[model samples]
Target: MRIIVYGSLRREQGNSHWMTNGQWLGDHVIDGYELYSLGHYPGVIKGMGKVYCEVYRIDATMLAELDALRSKGGEYKRELTSTPYGSAWLYVYQHSMAGRKRIVSGDWLQRDKES
Candidate 1:
């Protein structure tokens, strides 16, 4: 599956490294979906804040592992996101970002060329 990461998990050495597949679909600068209320909802926040990540097509096992990684963040839930490249598995803001401004394309924040 093609995964769309919005946070530090995009880092080459982030804790979610276990979910990284053989190749990255592309480098994307997506928005940060902040979780609120002890990880229950998205709450209030604009979808403008940027985050960088390498998109990849992983397997079911990887998807499950990613779901586990998401548990670390309090209020994130899986949702479908349409990206420039294609459809992706995006972690929704849930009730945390209830009234935030929406963004079409998120930002990629990885500055390291190696990443």
Candidate 2:
């Protein structure tokens, strides 16, 4: 399976260890989604801006680990979305974005550096 990660899970970012077993597919720009700063990490939700992320090919074990880390079915929902590597899973934030700082640039690493 393949997954697109935009936040701390990106290469060299915090929580990136979860992807140590996965193959880095390369960076990608996903349109129609907005990225936000959620303190130490970031989250994405359907919106008008584009989101910068990295794609990775992972196995079932890694998928399960990611699901747990993302609080699948709760804070975030894993949805299949189109990517350069065909369809891939993306974690959509389920919580409210009220008061959360929007990462207008859609790049988590850039936002992290500014914060």
Judging by lDDT against the true structure, name the best candidate. Answer: 2
Residues 1-115 of candidate 2 have per-residue lDDT tens digits of 8999999999888889988999998889999999999899999999999999999999999999888989855999999999989789999999999999999999998895655
CA lDDT of each prediction against the hidden true structure: 0.53, 0.92
- CA RMSD per model (angstroms): 7.0, 1.5
lDDT of 1 by residue, 14-98 (tens): 4546654635678765554432222212222334455445577778888887788665655457776666678887775444344
Which candidate gets the maximum TM-score versus the true structure?
2
Model 2 pairs in collision = none
Reference-based lDDT, residue 31, model 1: 59
Candidate 1 lDDT at 36 equals 28
